[model samples]
Target: MQKVTFKIRRFDGEKSWLQEYQFPYHPGKTILWALSYIKDSIDPTLTFTASCRHAVCGACAVRVNGQATLACETLLDKMLDRWKTDTLLIEPLQNFEVIRDLVVDWEAKVERLAEVKPWLIPRDEFSKETGCRQTPEDFKKINKNSDCILCGCCASECNKLSSNDRDFLGECLRFCVSGK
Candidate 1:
């Protein structure tokens, strides 16, 4: 295809709309690259969040055609092939308050996490100066769950949380604290 089109859902705090943008297509480009190109070359007002371009940071997570995926890790060609289309619909993640285009409010999520107190309480023997030490085997048990970057991808895909987030915390938070 000579060009790729993005139907991006935009929110201006008070209003929401879908805007379409088309740009020259390049091989091996990622969803994040398209967003950056649109923002830098076409519309300066477009907004999104991304950091640590690698998948380690979850800041770039967004809903691509109704599914949550990390923008940085998803390739445009792969998505096009999967959907068999040159157009893609990009929107903010579900089960969260939208602050703006592709930006969701994380303040409440952080507050919920804080309420659970997801931290290790060292034994009395382990003082503040020395710190608590864990064996390699002990650390390995929770290593995978601890890798959660709170990108809200799991929450977006979760049926329970999507139905009622106020009553249920996302799996990310649950797994993150379960290790503690």
Candidate 2:
């Protein structure tokens, strides 16, 4: 097995530092797997957040080699090919508060979404007492927009938010609005 190094930027409440660790490489394993290995076997203090190891939960998003992406969805082989190296720099997503190793505070995004009122404001029903019903064809048209898993990947990659000049509603809210 080949050796892979993960250079992680760590933040505690008082300060920040870089921590490095190495692991055995297996083909087709994801960054999440490597992180889990580090946390489980190497260092118990290494903290990150994840649930639904598949891509559905969006809880495992972190910056892999400086790109905002889901850890479960990113393969180590592909990342190694892209960067031509065995060392991967994993960091918490940009444009948010870093809670620890790879977890970021999502309160700002949630608070912003609250301001936008992302819930459905139903249209008047054709049947006076019931809710409006959408046809199959109408549902199909907007189906792709509903695929958003609220991962905040778009928010981390947003040009406006990255600029740190003005606060902007993230793409997740925009996607919700467009879908409705």
Candidate 3:
């Protein structure tokens, strides 16, 4: 087991602190695993949010060494590689308030999706019994956005969303609106 140093930034409602930890890095080591190890055997004070250990759930997404990625999906090598060359700044995603450590206020991202009405507005007479009829071609037209898991990754990196103006819904809007 290779020891990897993790310098974690932590914040509660009242105060903030930095803590360094060391963990064993294996071939397929992930950021979530590192946090888990730190949380378990190490400092229980460190706090974050994670779920579904797979990338399918967005709950574990955080900025790893300054780049936004799902913690469960990103390999430790990638993070360590970047860290070795430069100091890895692991901060919560921009444009959101830090609830604690890596966890930030994610409600705003979901609110943005709600603002856009991401789902298709039903036409008159479209009934549940009938099920909104659509062919494969219709799906092909909107398939590009079908993969959206509401991970908020795009919003995390979006420059426009960082601005104070709340009107701009950001890139997810483009994805939602792009009917092609």
How high is the lDDT of residue 42 in model 1?
100
lDDT of 1 by residue, 14-106 (tens): 999999999999999999999999999999999999999899878999999999999999999999999999999999999888999999998
Candidate 2 structure quality by residue, lDDT tens digits, 1-180: 379999999988769998999999899999999999999999999989889988998899999877999999899899999999989899998888888878888887887788878655567655667657888997876676667788878778777877762556655544843545
Clash pairs of candidate 3?
none
After superposition, the stretches of candidate 1 with alpha carbons farther than 4 Å from their true spots are: 174-180
Supply candidate 2's per-residue lDDT for 26: 92
Q: Which of 1 and 2 is ahead in lDDT? A: 1
Off by over 4 Å in 3: 85-88, 170-180
Whole-model lDDT, model 3:
0.74
Model 3 Cα lDDT, one tens digit per residue, 1-180: 357777777888878787778766667778888889889998887788888888776788788776788888888877777667323455677667789888888676667768768787767879989978878998886777766766667677777777753777554533843543
- Using TM-score as the yardstick, the better of models 1 and 3 is 1
Model 2, residue 101: what's the lDDT? 76
lDDT of each: 0.89, 0.83, 0.74
Candidate 1 has an lDDT of 0.89
Could you tell me how far off, in angstroms, the CA of residue 16 lies in candidate 3 after the best superposition?
Answer: 2.2
TM-score of 2: 0.87
Considering every candidate listed, which one attains the maximal TM-score?
1
Model 2 misplaced regions, further than 4 Å? 124-132, 172-180
